[model samples]
Target: MRRDIFTDEHEAFRDMVRQFIAREVTPYHEQWERDGVVSRDVWRAAGRAGLLGIDIDEKYGGGGNPDYRYYAVMNEEFARAGATGPMFNVHNDMIGRYLDRLCTPEQRERWLPGYCSGDLIAAIAMTEPGAGSDLQGIRTTATRTGDHYVLNGQKTFISNGQLADIVIVVARTDPAQGHKGISLLVVERDMPGFARGRNLDKIGLHAQDTSELFFTDVRVPGANLLGAEGGGFVALMQNLPRERVTIGVFALAVADKAFEDTLAYVKQRQAFGQPIGSFQHSKFLLAELATELAVARAFTDKAIAAHCDDELSVQEASMVKWWDTELCNRVTDRCVQLHGGYGYMREYPVARAWADSRVQSIFGGTTEIQKEIIGRSLGL
Candidate 1:
């Protein structure tokens, strides 16, 4: 199916992203996987290429384009290339919005330049040891004292954890206000009593750093507060739609590429002295998969268009995230089965893709959580 969501300029940008990935990401991905983190050089390179902050102000070293399609194009190319090492999406899509919308002028002047330039990497600490999807359940606390807030908490499974120069820590400011008590405080690197735990070993996305962060008796200046005090939950609710949509975009891209690869594989691999694709089972399977992908692409593109217009609802974003991620898991699993014995081998791209697809339904709010949101929206 022809995707009409993008213009010529977007296509041109896609070409540039492909070239950048080929030069920067593909070559070092394996080593990064072994090291459990990507080199900071790639982050700097992406910044130099104007990929780190697409929607940020150009005066701050960003591309200054508010168009979301640019981000979609880049994520699709990265997925197709099977390069999940750099984690630019986490930087640009997940954390950038907070800084863009909530930062005071003084805060922006201090952080945006380094963020857009890739000199300062950012991460958000929301999920704590006790909480994953429930914001109301967080236990981290920040007590105001003089000019600073004493932040004490632990965050696990933080992306870009090891390399992040500044972390937006979600801490409870008023214990009695429940979720309303949450506040976002900036915790910069090398602050006394701020420490990072080991790089966690995960089932997939080996090159992306995931870690546990610890803050104890750390006094974060009042100047580092991201938004209004006690507004972190609302801020998270606003930005999470973008993050979920980004995950959906990535999921669809992986499924599309996996289907393409598997289709080619079936045509070339012989069984019973004939190309496997010549068999009725293989042909029909490919046909079904192709149809499903086309349908998914149509809906996913629609969602992306809605998002670009800033009209994407939470329920709609939930639908896109859950449907596409589950579809991606289904497609990758079937593709692996189609590959037979070769699919289980780690060297094959399909094998790696299968492993990588497992986490999509788990993160960015689990599929179950998405369904719960959708169900509640329906007045269930």
Candidate 2:
């Protein structure tokens, strides 16, 4: 099972990222989990290691490579290593696109340096307290004043919410137009009336900070607007495919790691005076899991290629997102079972992985949403 999507150069970059994580991430991950947030030092280390913005412009302190494979490589390493704390995928794959592709030149000059340097952490506010996947249901509003837009809304379950210096707030500019009224405004830290609620406690991904954000008449300058007014929904639609595909990529990597861990566990754990893996049931299960992962991997690789080529369709992205995420959950659950009593213990990686994998099928558009998108694409 060789992947042709990456070149030798990509492998080299992957090695560098792996080493960086070992040095900068793994040692402090447990402390971070206890702290309920990652240290800003890691973000700065990522910037120094050239891992923050591979696709951003070089003049702004980025790697300047538009190739998306670098991100896939990074995602694979992060998943395989069970590193879920750093919200790099959200930054580089999701928010970075909006800033890199949709921002005005002035905005880039103002933000890209810190963005690429990791001095300014970014997050996009899309999901509201009431609106999950239904963008048309958003009630957040940003009304234009003499020179600024008055923003008032609350965003929940926001990744990197507590640490973000720049939040791209999605709000309605034309309340009468529904989805067409949506717009993106950059709300910087210390903006009057912009407040963050407590970092939420979660079942898993304990190292990653999630929080609720409140904007009470937060005045955002006109220059902070991202893209054209009333164009936020369209912009989101265009960029969501990338986010979905990245989730799928993460799914495959986690599944592969789970399978590998289970395989190792079964071969070592004895049953009836012999390795459990020697049993027909365990052997077949391992074989089946491996085969399933290979099939999904092939499709995910194709999706990544299509995305890099700007040809990945929404339907195809949905298909992979749901399929791989579901597969990750199923495989991880089975892996936990195969670990017997040990899997139930929090000390085991499989136990933690089980908890961490649960959210994949729900976030980045739920599995039901993905299916609906696919169904509609098929003219159902």
Candidate 3:
């Protein structure tokens, strides 16, 4: 299917992202997987290539282009390349918004330059040891002192935790107010008593660093507060739609890649003196998969457009997140079955994609969560 979303400029940007992945991501991905984290050098290279900060202002060393299509292009290319190691989506899509939109002038001057330059790797520490998806359940607390907030909490499954120079931590400021009490604090590296636990051993996405972060009497300066003292929950909700759309787009792109790869595989690998795809079952299956993919692409493209216009709603975003990710999982699973034993091999890109795609539906809010949000909006 021909996607009408991209113009010549978008395609040109896609080419640059493809080249950046080829030069900076692909070669080192294997070693990174073994090392359990990607090198910060690639992050710097991405910054230099104008891939790190597409929406950030140029004065702060960013691309200064707020158009969302450019980000969509980058995510699609990353999915196609099977380069899931970098958390560029997390950095550029989620955390960048808080910095770009809400940061005070002084805060922006202090952080935006390195953030755009990749000198300061950023991560949002929202998921805690006990909290996953339920923001209200977070136990991390930030008690105000005269000049700083004394933070005490533990965050697990933090992407970029080990490498983050700046962490946007979600903590309770006035516990009595529940959600309204929550606030965002900028926790910088090497702040006294701030510590990172070991890089976690995960089932997949090995090159991406996931770890536990500890803050015991960690003094975060009052100036480091991201937004209004208790406006963190609102800020999180505002940016979540973009983050969810990013996941949906990535899911569709990767499913398309898997379909393309599997289609070629079925044509060449002979079974019983004929290409397996020649069989009736294979043809019907592939036909179904192809149709499903096209259907998803159509919806996903529209969601991206709505998101760019800042017109996307909570319900719509949830629908896109649930449907596309579930479809991505379903499509990849079928493609793997079509590959038979070979699909199970770790060496094949399909195998890695299968593993990587699992977390898509799980993270960015679970599919069940998306459905609940949608259901509630409908007066369920």
Candidate 4:
């Protein structure tokens, strides 16, 4: 079914995104996967293409567009291209929101130009070895000194960890206050005692860098503090719905692309001298997947629209996140099954997509965690 949620401008933006991906991302993706990170040059190219900070103020070198549909279009195109290398969604959707919302004028002047231009990449560090979803469980400490906050902590599973020029570090500013004690400090690259561990190998998403970050007595200037000193928890909570929606956008796009590819494959690949898709079982499976995907697309688009309108609730975001990501995993798994033995090969897109889609339900909050949020919203 045709989606009416986007206007001509969005379609035009989608076209430009596709062209940009074709030129900048497609050729280098394989080499990037082998190297465990994308080239920083593509980031610069993305910046040049006006893809980095869509909602940031034009005075700060951004497109000055706050319409979330543009971002949705970009993510959908990237997923369809199977170009997960640059982590643009992380740069644009996740960290950009933080900087846009929390940055002081001086901080914005310092960071936004480079950030929008992709000269300085950004990452947010929240999950630690001891804490994943439970924000209250974090142990990373930040002690206020005369002129700065002394940060001491380790963060794991940080996206853009290896390449980020600036990392928004979440630390305990007041350990005595539990969740209320948390704060966000922007830790720059040359900050003393700040170190990055090896780029960790993952089950998939080889081109995107995820790593461990260490901050030992790293003194962050007080000016780098984001929002209120102990407002990190509330800030994270407010932004999480948008993050989950971003994840859902990618998940649903991947699932849709997988189905599109598999549909063509089943119709062409012969089994016992007949197209496999002609068989009753294969036909039935395709029918079911098609129905599910249509339903998911409708709901996902609705959620996107809600987010644009600033009306998306945490419960609704969680619902879309878990449901779409789980659907992505399911669709990819079945696509591999339809491909039979060929699907097991890493060379096939379906195989790679299957691996990539697995992490969707895990990150952006686990499927179980999302369900828990939904249940709590029901007053259970």
State residue 177's C-alpha deviation in candidate 2, in Å. Answer: 1.1
Clashing pairs in 1: none
Candidate 2 C-alpha lDDT tens digits along 69-105? 9999999999988899999999999999999989888
Per-candidate TM-scores read: 0.99, 0.99, 0.99, 0.99
How much is 123 displaced in model 3, in angstroms? 0.2
Model 1, residue 71: distance off in Å is 0.5
Q: Model 4 lDDT vs. the true structure?
A: 0.94
The root-mean-square deviation over C-alpha atoms between each candidate and the true structure, in angstroms, is 0.8, 0.8, 0.8, 0.6
lDDT of 1 at 28: 95
Model 3: residue 71 alpha-carbon error in angstroms:
0.3
For every model shown, the clashing-pair count is: 0, 0, 0, 0
Instruction: Tell me how many residue pairs clash in candidate 2.
Output: 0
The 10 consecutive residues of candidate 1 with the worst lDDT sum are 127-136
Among the numbered candidates, top lDDT falls to: 4
Q: Quote the lDDT for 36 in model 2.
A: 95
lDDT of each residue in 1-380, candidate 3, tens digit only = 89898899999988888989989999999999999999999889989998877899999999999999999999999998899989999899888998998999999999999999989999999998789989889999999999999999999999999899999999999999999999999999989989999999987889999999999999999999999999999999998888899999999899999999999999999999999999999999999999999988898899999988889999999988889899889988998999999999979988898988888998878898899999999999
lDDT of 4 by residue, 1-380 (tens): 99999999999999999999999999999999999999999999999999999999999999999999999999999998889889999989999999999999999999999999999999999999989988888999999999899999999999999999999988999999988899999999999899999999999999999999999999999999999999999999999999999999999999999999999999999989999999999999999999999999999999999999999999999999999999999999999999999989989899989988799998878999999999999999
Q: Which stretches of candidate 2 lie over 4 Å from their true place?
A: none
